[model samples]
Target: MYERLDKLRAEVERCKRKVEDDRQRLKAAEQKLQEAENTQILADVGALNLSPEQLADFLKLVANGQVGSAGTVSTVTAVNKETEVETKDDDDYDLEGLEDEEN
Candidate 1:
């Protein structure tokens, strides 16, 4: 009877520890899921490239159903800036130390 009682107590303790571990893993997974969702939302918002005031106004207009047709929504133009090209050539170095071997 004592042996059976000891086995039951050990099993309960093991189950408790397992449950705690599972809870921690679950919490981490939930945090990762939330972060991923936030990343997706930020990516979508970033793609819009709207300033804070413009985004807020656009969102408010959309929420209020103010923009009904294509004419009502203002046109947003994307500005393209000229970027400077990197002209550093790493493979063009002159090797001055090596002597030519005559075979």
Candidate 2:
């Protein structure tokens, strides 16, 4: 009878410890979920507020030199300017060809 009583007491202690561990895990999980919810809310706000052009420019800026990568603002800006000039030159050529055809 005494041995059986000791076993019951040990089992109760084990159950208590397990319950405490489960409670701690539940609390940590809830905290993590709350953090994720906050992050998602911020992302939604940004998506709703920033226009496509603004978002594109921001991404370009980050990709260029802001993200700890090996890129410089000067280089990225120069490349973009170069691309614009090429596009403008192509437009000029098209206009010239149209003028020649008219003549």
Give TM-scores for every candidate, taking all chains together and pairing residue i with residue i: 0.58, 0.47
Candidate number achieving the greatest TM-score relative to the actual structure: 1
Model 2 alpha-carbon drift over 4 Å, by segment: 50-103
Best prediction by lDDT? 1
Over 1-103, each residue of candidate 2 has an lDDT whose tens digit, in order, gives 5999999999999999999999999999999999999999789758756555655664677676543343322223223322321112233344776779999
Q: What TM-score would candidate 2 get against the native?
A: 0.47
Q: Which digits, one per residue and each the tens of the lDDT, describe model 1 over residues 3-55?
A: 99999999999999999999999999999999999999999989977776666
CA lDDT for candidate 2 = 0.63
Q: Please, what is the whole-model Cα lDDT of each candidate in the order they appear?
A: 0.66, 0.63
Clash count of each predicted structure: 0, 0
In the order shown, the candidates' Cα RMSDs to the true structure are: 15.5, 15.5
Please report, as a residue range, the 10-residue window in candidate 1 with the lowest summed lDDT: 79-88
